[model samples]
Target: MSSLKKDVCNPYFSHIYIEKDVLKHPVTKKILSLFPNAQSLVINHYKDIFCRKNQNFSLQKQTPGLILARKHDNLVYEGAPVCQNFGNQHFYYTSSVMNCIYDCEYCYLKGMYPSANIVIFVNLEEIFKEVKGILARHPVYLCVSYDTDLLALEQVLGYTKEWIRFTAEHRDLTIEIRTKSANKKVLDEVRPDKNVVFAWTLSPEKITVDFEKHTPAFEERLSCIQAAVKKGFQVRLCFDPLIYCRDWKEQYRNMFQRVFSCIRADEIKDVSLGVFRIPQDYLKRMRKQAPASAVLQFPYENDKGVYHYHKDLTEEMISFSYELVRKKLPMEKIFLWEKTKEEK
Candidate 1:
């Protein structure tokens, strides 16, 4: 039996509550020890922390810890990117966990939060109920694992597994778990649901190695996606925030070829393309955090509060990449996320 199947039997975590009851399980106690100063926030069925604002790189690198907070059952949009993309359609997203384990330099988390502590919202059932209510009105697409990679922390939190079970029961609901984790253990334990899409944000090998610090290698991520496809999971490809690199076209062409070669076209559900863009405030914070990073120093055009590549260059990249990917995937299966004029 896997360690996950074994009942959480630990004593140090006796003060932690799952729903309302304080859990004395040994494993839970061990996990709690990682954050000794955290306060238990119990809001309705969910319990987590109300973390302090400005948790950017400077604060997190000093004392990396976890925050415990309960998410309000009524609220859905948890983090940044709140107004863009699906936010317009009233599509809901809830983060049971906050602060990712990986340390990608391009990640907005560096600018968004002042700390690196992982915040876990314990009241999951209430969130599920809220989701059910939302889905009753119209077919909903929910993006899970956005703020954090749920699969990487699956052994510690089991929230991803619970989500799998929840989405499996609700066919009207579409759940997308976007991740960079290469953990295959979590995938093996849970069967795939047709309504759930396991989306992986992929980059070129050079970019993955150089820019995405501490993340899984490009090949490893591809292998994980391949495994998920074999398990009957609907997989989506995201070549988002395409980094501008030397020999950029060749790099992207090789990446697309490598991706299609590993996974069949029929197994893929869809592909989303978006060039790198960040809010002005976040970019300022990120620049302060890493003064030497070329990614931060690159000349960017500020459209409103967000910063992105120049319009002409960004559009060209998007068009070229989308065209290349479309050759491998059907037109209906391709989704392009670019900034429109009104968005500027």
Candidate 2:
């Protein structure tokens, strides 16, 4: 077992009654220390904590920490499209957990939420119940993880594993776990379910090296995805927030070519493409955090409250990426996020 697994065996986790006891776990302890005065609510599971109306800013700033535990009331439904949800498939995304492990400069979590702490909702049963309710209605396309990368913390949480098992039983519900993690230990323990699609967000090596601090290298992510494909996992590729850089065309083309060389085209389920964009308010917060970043410095056009690359450039990048990915994946497998006319 991994060191992360061993940490769970600690005595502090025995009493899940009081919120304070939940924080007694060394992982939770380290996180709670950041917010000494913040109250803890120990519920039956992770999904119980409601987002306090005004708490978004404060929560987004802390180094990721645990939040309230409760089961999800509903699952298997579509979410409004924001900066992250792509493919325009009317995605139904459930947050088995909140916050992320990686700290990318462009991440909206930095601007949208006030805290940087990770909130792990331990209530899997509730989410499952909600999902069951949805599956009863229609064939649901679910995004298992949008707020956090369950795969990255798989050993510690076991939520993704549970989700995989759940999806395996429900063939009518299509699930996607989007992640940037290179961790494949979970793959060793669980077989890939046909209904569970393993989607990875890929970027050029340069972008990973510069902007995506602490994230796995591009090659490492590709290697992990290839390993999953070999195990019969339905794998999908996402080249989103395509950062603008000098020689971006050459960089992206090479990246695409390299990906195809490593993973067979037939193994890939589909590709989703989107240019970099963020809510305007989030951009301001990110800029405050890191003023020196070229990503933060770029003059973005604002559509409503969201900021993005100028209309023409955003379209060009999206179009170019769509064509490039189409070279390896079929058109039906390629989904491009079109910018709204107002966004132009």
Candidate 3:
């Protein structure tokens, strides 16, 4: 392991809960070796701890524990309506890990999951089998880093490389791995694959520092994006969930100039834009956990079951970003998230 990996493996978890069935699994064993000092406890299933009622999600987030288990069913899911399909007919996502290491105040995981602790499924073959079954029918655009940032945890988990290798074998399978990680070591070690798209989420420096706790600074993430583009990787830029603030326009304007300055917009595969929105239930849970958070506490309008900024504000943000990106790339390459007429 590299010095950076060795250092990160030590501090994240003090206790690890392993499923009895996967205690002997290679992935589980390898993960255990990285944190020899952490106490290990065997459990029947991940949900025994992860789904427990009254788990202080906020408190556990401060120093979350780890759960290693085997996922037997529902390994892959149809992409949610809120997610951008990018014009793919058969879009799906799988979660090898659940809950994120970085705690963004606007993150829906806080409300979608009962616990803040991280869960890493040790069985990749099962997930691969499920994907293969789906691919047998038709082409697939799979988002591997759906629920978690796989590249950020690459040092400890090494699943990102495995997904890339798997994609290389299956011509019909195209995967998108989204991340805010600044870990350039991953890009350096892994070979680039055209079938695999590396999507980096970019936020203005002010919003990143204020709401995205424990994440790499904006400059660091920008540097990683540059490295990926230079290495022949299919890169996609995501400016989604555009947070609303008095100075949002200025921040996003400066961010666009800074990004296109370093990496040519034509070099990337595409760019995605969406305003910050969440399920109504999720916003309720998040508000409870972080009552003082301006991001969470804002009085957003309810459109059906989702909470979002008013329609006018949403349009202003997306349109502003679209025009800026249109200056650099053709209209075909820019994607915007809009509700269907039925949905509206």
Candidate 4:
């Protein structure tokens, strides 16, 4: 059952949905070449097929369709407040893809989008040009994988490799590709660049099994991080959206012990920690989309516009993580929401 689960768990892109206009484009052709067996469906626009009503996100994830489309406008967006800017003056994020392959119970994408399918913008060069123009004025920090996990889809998409080359040319440009994937081979393919940070999102094994569905387990994610770091990549570990599970303190404490034991503390760029949070409206929509989800059903406190663990729980989680991280890594290397309570 476990072996079979591994084979069936990963989302398979069995159908290719291509925008009619990009049918002749080289990227579309190359992507189609990768999946020659996938049935091709031509459409006028991606959202037309991707944003359809009554589509089951979970069901579609089993046999997901790939949408190759052209992004018309808003090539880049200012980074959201919820995300850590890492002290960048001009931070931005671009969604070359719409959705993720893995199905995490607490993921906001389920609420933010109407489809379970993955959308890849074939026009990668255009987004780069937009960044180049933005760079003409100021140094820019971009999070390219905010909307989707680029590492997980690297085999077919290879957008991260393209971004690596793009960053190589633009000295002023810095990008962060965040993922929960532990695909070691994909991580090794790209040349590690300080300008391009590979941030791994890590969770305790218990939370991983319960909240993060279809994801690489905690140990796998740690090994992936060690491999990247050994390969000379600036690795950032994110304990973000910290889950409040059974014996939460002990869970996180043991997880941290296992984490620093295998990976060198001094080599890590930084560690980010935060309690569970979702846009108030997104959580509302997620509850509607996944009514059975206990993670979303938790009665959270609304602070301004976002829904999150109440102040007390929020502080406890972040403070506990901060203390644990500081013990092994430098205090400066610790990054979090900066709860009112500080740990020494």
Candidate 5:
């Protein structure tokens, strides 16, 4: 069985939920064709299943259902305050999918949604239409894979390929598809376009093994990053949500050495740095789901509505990682997320 199949309790997507409105949509049909063995049910709306109360997020993750639905309104949204804008004035993000395949302990999705099932919005053309409208007014830097790892599900959904093709036609639209996926086959399948950036979020091997459950190992992710750079794809390396640990400095230093050794610093588009921070309400939900997670149980300081590591520690982590990266790449290529101060 495939690694992904092994990660889940049952075969991948044993049960599929289809919103009745999109049952006849071509995108839905294509997905259904790929999973003929999957038992699917048609429902009036995706929320009926996705937002239902009292769903056990952890239990359902082992055998998570797939939901095919149409996104009606608010196809594009201004970037969230917690997210790094990377100096883009017209930054925005759109979620073609609702949840992720990998269940990282530090993930905000656990608190953002009520269910663990993956939801794929089958209406890409509608989303593209909205993006074009924004591009007409000013250049748009959009994050297409914000809510889910689109590249990880590329074989099943093929949304990443579609986004690459769409980007080729629009000079003013630059889209970033961030993922922890180590699927190198995607590099061969999709042609590289300058307007499309493939951002990989990497962590230390220890963190990958302990906290980032079911994600690619540190070496696997690094290998994929090398593959992406060789294919001439615009690659961005994200060290964001930097997990705090007793030996984080040693781990991060070693990771930086391995990364720069495999690929030249000039080849990278840019690097981003951030310590773990999540909305307060999301952390509350996460604690309820995984009460024993060390990463979750940490006494994080509440900066406004966001919970994160203490200020001194957060600065120390980012500065240490930033200095290591600066040795290889110029300061212009580094983007770090910092906290804003408010009267206490």
Candidate 6:
């Protein structure tokens, strides 16, 4: 165990929660190796700890635990109305991992999950088989990392690499691994695939520092995207969930300038744009978690079951963003969020 002492547990989690059923999984073993310094406790199921009642979400978020278990049910789900389907025939997302390392004030995970601890499904082969079974009948468009920043955990999990290889073998499967991580080592470890789209969510430096706690800086994230473009990867930029802040226009304008300064606009596969929006229930839960956060206090109109900027501001924000990026990339390559026909 002396050599194990040298293993620094990702510096994010204080403990590793391992389900008794997955204790021997190779992926679980690999994850344990990375967090050798962390306390390991055995449990019958991940939800036993992950879904415990009265867990303090905010406090747990400061020192989240890592839970390794097998995903028994609901391996995949249809992409929600809040997400961009990218005109795919069959769009779906999987929560192979739950929760994230970063603590963004606007994150919806706090509302979706009962705990802030991260849960990783150790059974990769089962997920692959399930995906393959679906692909046998129809071409599938899957979002592999919607619920968590899988790429940020790539150093330990390596599931992103597995997905990359899986997609390379299955010609009919297309995947989007959306992330805000600046870790570029994973980029060099796997072969770039045309079927895989690497999407990075960008935020203004001020917003990032203020609302997005413990995430990579704007410059760092840009460097990683530049590296990906240079390596011939299908890199996509997601300005989705764009938060409104003081001097947002000037800040976003500078952000756009900084983004194009590193890579040619033509090199980007596509750009997605959307202003901040969340389900009404999720906003209610988030409000309870962080009462003082100005983001939660914003006068977001409750339209149907969703809470978002009022109609006029929503139009102005999206239109202003489109006009700004229009200078760098062709309008054809831009994807805008379409509101529900009746705002229902």
Q: What's the C-alpha lDDT at position 121 in model 1?
A: 68
Q: Number of backbone collisions per candidate, in order?
A: 22, 31, 0, 0, 0, 0
After superposition, the stretches of candidate 6 with alpha carbons farther than 4 Å from their true spots are 1-11, 340-344
Error of 6 at 309 (Å): 0.7
Better of 2 and 4 by lDDT: 4
How well is each residue in 1-344 modelled by candidate 4, as lDDT tens digits?
Answer: 01235366544777889999899988899899998788899999998989898887766766678999999889999988888888788999999999998888899998788888999999999999999999999999999999899988888888889999999999999999999999899666778888989899988899999888789999889888889989889899998879887688999999999999988886788888888888988898788876777788998999888898888788777878888888899877877764333321
RMSD of each: 7.0, 6.9, 4.2, 3.0, 3.0, 4.6
Local distance difference test, each candidate: 0.73, 0.72, 0.91, 0.86, 0.91, 0.87
lDDT of 2 at 342: 32
Misplaced by over 4 Å in model 5 are: 1-9, 340-344
Expressed as tens digits, the lDDT of each residue in 1-344 for candidate 6 is 01122143334666898999999999888888877788899999998999899887877787788999999867888889888887787999998999998888999898888999999999988888899889999999999999999888888788899999999999999999999999899888988899999999998888889888889998899999999998889999999888888788898888888888887988889999988889888888888888888988799998888898999888877888888889889987888876732332
Per-residue CA lDDT of model 5 for 1-344, tens digit only, reads: 11234554776589999999999999999999999999999998999999999998988777789999999999999999999888899999999999999989889999999999999999999999999999999999999999999999998999999998999899999999999999999899888888899999999999999889889999999999999999899999999879988899999999999999999987889999888999999999999888888999999999889999988887788878888999999999988884522211
TM-score head-to-head 5 vs 6, winner: 5
Off by over 4 Å in 3: 1-11, 340-344
Residue pairs with colliding backbones in model 4 are none
Candidate 3, 302: how far from true, in Å? 0.6
Report the Cα lDDT for candidate 2: 0.72
TM-score of 1: 0.82
Deviation in Å, model 3, residue 214 alpha carbon: 0.9
TM-score of 6: 0.94
Least lDDT summed over 10 consecutive residues: which range in candidate 2? 9-18
